[model samples]
Target: MLKVQEIRELIKLVDQSNIEEFVYEHEGSKVEMKKKAGIAVPVAVSPSVQPVVQEVVHMEQKPVQTAALQTETKQEPAAAEAEQIDTSNLHQVVSPMVGTFYQSPSPETDAYVKQGSKVTKDSILCIVEAMKLFNEIEAEVEGEIVEILVKDGQLVEYGQPLFLVKPE
Candidate 1:
């Protein structure tokens, strides 16, 4: 089995290279990666892996283009709404790694922080679980929690905003 750091390094290498697909197998572990729409998605297959067969079908471009245009039009308002927010005074706390965001230490516990919660630099804000490891995320700045950007148990990408804080 590959270590987490090794997997992260592999991901970085694959992302930087021009290769569209990559596959690695050692012993019983298999790692498959592919680029789709310029995004690198990595999949780790277990020891007992089964080959997947996919069928490709040809489609007309005109209807797809029209649908894409309509989707873009519908998303314009959300962009406009986001532009109206004053983010100058807020500090974004971003995820340090790709993981599942957990608002509390456990399911039965209260959240570490919520809107209006005051925090110091050493305060624990949440936990980000990656590869069965629970990493405690801290409030790196002294501030009040302004917003929680993700929901509990949501998968988060590296450098993605997890919280907005109004710094004191």
Candidate 2:
């Protein structure tokens, strides 16, 4: 609910103050901050995605403490990157919204893309049904489908990874 600058300012203020814990909730949005080792860090929660944590480290040499703001996301992208096999530079296509995952255009139709299938930039990988609408999910990169992250009819959350592709 707050702007990035406002959030940054809040983190800075919390870092500088003696307040051990700070919690702010407004209109279903919440922010939690804690004082850790004389530095203030924020722990953010989102209903659809993973938790995002930002760490602020203040140094006395800096007057504005702008340099203290650094994001250390709890859902580490590095760890995800490490999990991918190094043989190919795999790219993950994630669900853009909360929906039911579907492998084919329809039950009788063949799957748009399957494991080991080559896909071009415009290839339709699958469909995601959200609010009774079927949204065609297209491949943004040319690749081979190494893995399918969700099964047909599976409910997927926003940002949930759906496919792993080895780029051609």
Displacement of the residue 136 alpha carbon in candidate 2, Å: 0.4
List where candidate 2 sits over 4 angstroms from the true fold.
1-88
Candidate 2 lDDT over 1-168, as tens digits, reads 455535555666576567899987766768787776666666564442122233222223243334424322344555576466563568899998766799998899999988899999899999987656789988889989988867788867678889988888
Q: Give the number of colliding residue pairs in candidate 2.
A: 0
- For candidate 2, the 10 contiguous residues with the lowest summed lDDT are 48-57
- Residue lDDT tens for model 1, 14-40: 665699998878677787878655544
- Local error of candidate 2 at residue 162 (angstroms): 0.5
Reference-based lDDT, each prediction: 0.74, 0.71
Instruction: Tell me the TM-score of each prediction against the true structure.
Output: 0.63, 0.50
